[model samples]
Target: MATKGRRALRLLGAPHITVACLLWFGVLTVWGTLYQADPLHGLHGAVQRFFHSWFFLAGGVVPLPGVQGTSALFLANLFASMLTRFERPSRAIGLWIVHVGLVVLFLGGLLSRQYGRETTLVLADGEKASMSVSETGWEIAVLTPGAEGRREVRAYDVRNLRAGGSLAVPGVPGSVGVVRVIYAAVVSPAAGLTPSPEQVTDAPAASDPRMDRPAVVLRAGDERLVLLGEGPAAVLHLEGGGEAHLLLRRARLPLPVSVKLIDFEKKFHPNSGIARSFSSRVEVDSGGRAREVTISMNRPYRHGAFTFFQSSYMDNPRGPEVSIFAVSENHARLLPYAATLIMFAGMAVHYLPRRRRT
Candidate 1:
């Protein structure tokens, strides 16, 4: 009687609970693999639509407040139920670890997406800015009158400073003139190469009296401002309003702290031209405490809660300079580590053979 009851209970649970868990995992795997390759394409949309509809139904069934961590909770419960029903310790441990890892990964993603901040800092040969813009690509810079009473400091959206577009200030009539950007291969002053025929052909007429250097022209109403690349700084013209800004998409860095690239070194294989290693020497000053660190390809430098990894590289006339550090910090990183260990151990025990006595 007991055996029959046990079998009956297993049959009852298998269809709804077990099948649901399998379906969820299968869908998640498929979605993850295909989402990146082609996001807006066919199966991706179908999968998204299916999940949306299912989630809607799930919302109706579970209700709001109770469903705070519905997906995670559901997965955890399913794993636990299977463990209890099957009496398979190794399988249970593996499932538990995998579920825990998923939970951690999800939590990490949530925290980073909601609270993570990123930005880039563009430092001229010797110039520095008071603050770094956020890297997610939108910026609003406010340029106020300086202490000297001369409005020297200019702030605006870097994204709005496009090659061929007029910018207008609010309440200010008219618009800034679009600057023409021409690309030409001039005689390399350092290399002493002759100018290409294309450069000669495309050169503006001497009668036009154009600026020799690369420049951008800004015309706000009757006022005209010319910004040249050879100049110390770009001149941003403002109207009567104190709040004149430009919006541009650039990498942003945190304020009060500045990163200076002291030196960048790259090492390559002797015979083969393949790169062997690269490193960056940088100085980071936070709240007056200065520290110097070297960041290498795989090796990351950690300070406080933040970590910086050697990410990319670029070559210039001076030398090859590596872009050191993709920085990030997250609170829930350990959960995934723990879950990985558990999953590996469980799988090992499940697969490996044990000695048997006759």
Candidate 2:
């Protein structure tokens, strides 16, 4: 057992291990970039299959190590080399500083993987929102309308559930089965056909997101209900008076503070029609008090555990300006800066004396 442990230590401390890790990282980066270029496979798909997994089938045949596995192995190799190989103080101080910086960068990536949470908040002019919705997380909500603006809701998680998948609807009588789903759908009324939200055309030719609607079908107790996400055909009349609304929406996270968009301003470059800058004037409601603030490009609003950045805007042209804010909550958000400063200090300490000798 002692001999085996020594051999393992030696192997981990080998320069070949580091070289292999770096080469694999390069391969993964290239693979991810190439995979996302395919129209059917998006960046999120590449992340889920390549970056988040331990191993993935490349080209549906060859196996490749993913980001998590490669990084974990590389980090272990680094620590092993630090303990077993980098023992002599006579070693170059510059090398030690670079190793420490690389370690910190790896650790920061791990921290982000564990603690970073991101979502988006979309607010129209004169709209108020107290929550943000995830861009990727999907949920199916079963809502029963009660008397006069009251509703009882039960939501089921259905992120990336494919066709033929079935899930039980809580508080409802029967199970719901997915017949068809279009992640990005276009909805338009066909001539001579009655315009109904449940009426859907065939799957789109490509991901041309003009209307940007999502169409889905749910089978419930011998009745296949055609539903559109947040569309007019969302609500169904029960046997009795109340209505059942089947909604497909992103999972929501409540915020401690509510924001009301009072006004939005956008400036275009001369003769270009490209937007130079856009901003939103918002009223923040926090702890029973309200304050006004403006959020713009490069300017973020930080409150509690969340930071909101003005990321993008959706222009309605004839309607209100739709402001989209990227919300991120990262526990180790400042670690990168700390690591950068440490690297800078280490570089200065190592190089200044050597320069003086010359």
Best by lDDT: 2
| Local distance difference test scores for all models | 0.49, 0.76
**RMSD per prediction, one decimal?**
13.9, 5.7
Error of 2 at 328 (Å): 2.6
Query: What are the runs in model 1 whose C-alpha is more than 4 Å off?
Result: 1-105, 118-136, 148-243, 319-324, 329-358
Off by over 4 Å in 2: 30-53, 86-101, 145-149, 160-244, 341-358
42-107, model 2: which lDDT tens digit per residue? Answer: 677677777878788877899878988888888888777766776774655665676687778788
Error of 2 at 164 (Å): 13
Question: Per-candidate TM vs. native?
Answer: 0.47, 0.70
Give the per-residue Cα lDDT of candidate 1 at 211: 24
